[model samples]
Target: MAIGDSVKPAAFQYHAPQSVEEAVQLLGMFASDDGRIIAGGQSLIPTMALRMARPSHLIDINGVGELEKLSVSDSVLSIGACIRHAAFHRPVVGNPLGGLLSFVVKHIAHYPIRMRGTFCGSLAHADPSSEWALTAVTLGATMIAESLRGRRELHADEFFVSIMATNLAEDELLVETRFSLLTPGTRFGFYEFSRRAGDYAVAMALVTFELVGGLIADVRVGVGGAEDRPRRLPEAEKVLTGHPPSARLFEDAAAAAAAAVDPMEDQQADAAYRRDLVAVVTRRALERAAA
Candidate 1:
């Protein structure tokens, strides 16, 4: 059955392809000012249903065989674009990232949603409040995208452009995401504050640090759900990079994180509230990483 017939209003034509090459060709066929690619129908389906997004053609990639792998290597973890959130919750798949990422994934939206939502789908949707986007950016992950022309790799910093927007082209498909494994002796922490569990986070913080002979060798921190986009706080990282992790250093990092981010006011929180959360969450995350 046609998607228009299945879904009311007949907003557009739909094509489901069985292979990546076929999907790419279908995308090319509908290469116009208003064509969109659909995967998992987790985010795009809802948006289309609301008519918030109206594409002349919907190229469904669910039947494509190339986008469903998750493999780990010596220094990197590679996940295909279509790998579902439930797949990520497996012990083998989720345990390596210090168990912190796994904790966050368990709280994303709901079980039914997680069962259908794909990691790359979440990243491509580019919701700043999304756990996947927030965590990936904090960890300095890489995103691989493919088009009829070719494939390109983008660092997490360059992949997300704004709220609900990304660097992907209309005809391009996100193929995989890669994350560099934290070095040995690296301490890691991930924390987010929300009104209740399983709801969108008000502010989220991720911290990674390397301790070299009891002194800090490197540090990185990222904050999300409190701004227009997920962002790394290099200033905060700089403050703690060489210093030993302590209460004073944690305070300094918290101050730096607060100063670095200019969060927007939303119905859930005000600018001042979000700024305060940045400090609180950053401090807690640093303390946990230090521990």
Candidate 2:
């Protein structure tokens, strides 16, 4: 069925620009009103179908040149806004942050959706259960957004405001995301729970740590699907940061993370259940990270 068939709305303007500059100008021109930028059309299309978003103008950015490049530099990996989830799973990418991100992307929604769901699209969509957002936050990534006015950068912690909310301006477009290169001693792990394999996560955990001389030197932990936005577990990280990776440390970190989150009771799971799941998955991920 057609999108308009599902959600009846008046036809609006559609423009597919060939360059980022052109798109920026178009956005500037329509900045006064309800204008939406469409990249992969994965999230926006569905929202439009459901009548949740009805923009007066649709600015398509797919044709913009060089927005799909995935480049790895000496200290960072820069992923363009248009890079799809499938691109992330390519072996040639040589992602050193463990297979956690690739595993999550490979299972997101299904093959058909993964084929079209762009990396930035998922970030921009800012769904609480989105693996891309969780992974980025866990890795201490940066998001780049641009507009006719200028450009701005946001750390993963500052980028996501709430569920389905972001720090992006209405006229700005997310152009790239940069992830720090994993150090040689860094260890990584990810875990998520859901009713089905391809379904959105009910609770997810990501952990990155470094082992120096058999001791934990640094640690970062992030959890998703348990709150309105993905969040780092600073208390949990502290519990593991300077200590040896032991069963006791993992347990303490998990308990700290569970106490830190404020999950809401939804149809998927109760608040208490999510809090418990956070502890469980945090422990599991920490175990894997320390292995």
Candidate 3:
């Protein structure tokens, strides 16, 4: 049988490639013909099932062993495309970044979803409410996109374009993401508001900062689910940096976050409600970090 002949195809063809080079070649051939790369399929499968996405070919990358790499090297945590969310249940490295990932991974839907969903897949999906995406933007992670053409590295700020969208080209696959390990004694916090336990977040915040001489330094505040994409809040960071952690300062930072964002409005939440949620989540995250 040919590569995709076994599966009874209604409209799409499936190809499983065992190596990264093979997959890239297939993508180069089929991307213009609506070929998509499937890893964990946490989001893509459902969309296909509902007939929302009608790709003619799916190049499954789960069999690509090279894409399953997860390691810490050169003071950075590198997560490969096939590394599932469950891998982060325990600290993957002996650093604050590992602990922070462990804490945030639990909020990524329920247990079963975590078992199959890949970290790189989440970033590729680019959901605004995704916990991993928020963490990536907040931590200044670098995304590596590969293809038959070439390889390119993108910072989190430039990688994500909007909800369920990214700057990745049609023929490119997200191969790996590198997150710099947090320094020792760094403080971090994350909080989100959702309608139910496993529902997508309505609004969320991830905050990190270091203290020097009892004053905050290197502060980063990221807000998500309230905007088109997860992004660091410079206005909020400005309020927190160089200041001692206090309830008043946290409140001010939260206010700045709320003021800075132009929130998304939908059936679940109006713009004003989302703005309020931004303030609440931002304040709560900052409080948790300070504590």
Q: What is the C-alpha lDDT of each candidate?
A: 0.82, 0.85, 0.94
Give the per-residue lDDT of model 3 (tens digit) for 64-141.
Answer: 999889999889899999999999999999898988999999899899999999999999999999999999999999
Better of 1 and 3 by TM-score: 3
lDDT of 2 by residue, 264-284 (tens): 678999999999999999999
TM-score of each: 0.91, 0.93, 0.96
For residues 89-167, write the lDDT of model 1, one tens digit per residue: 6543433473655666886888998998888898999988888888888888999988898889989989899989998
Q: Choose the strongest candidate by lDDT.
A: 3
Residue 104 local lDDT, model 2: 60
Q: Would you list the clashing residue pairs of candidate 1?
A: none
Candidate 3 has a TM-score of 0.96
Model 1 regions more than 4 Å off: 1-10, 31-33, 93-98
- Kindly indicate the candidate among 1 and 2 with the higher TM-score: 2
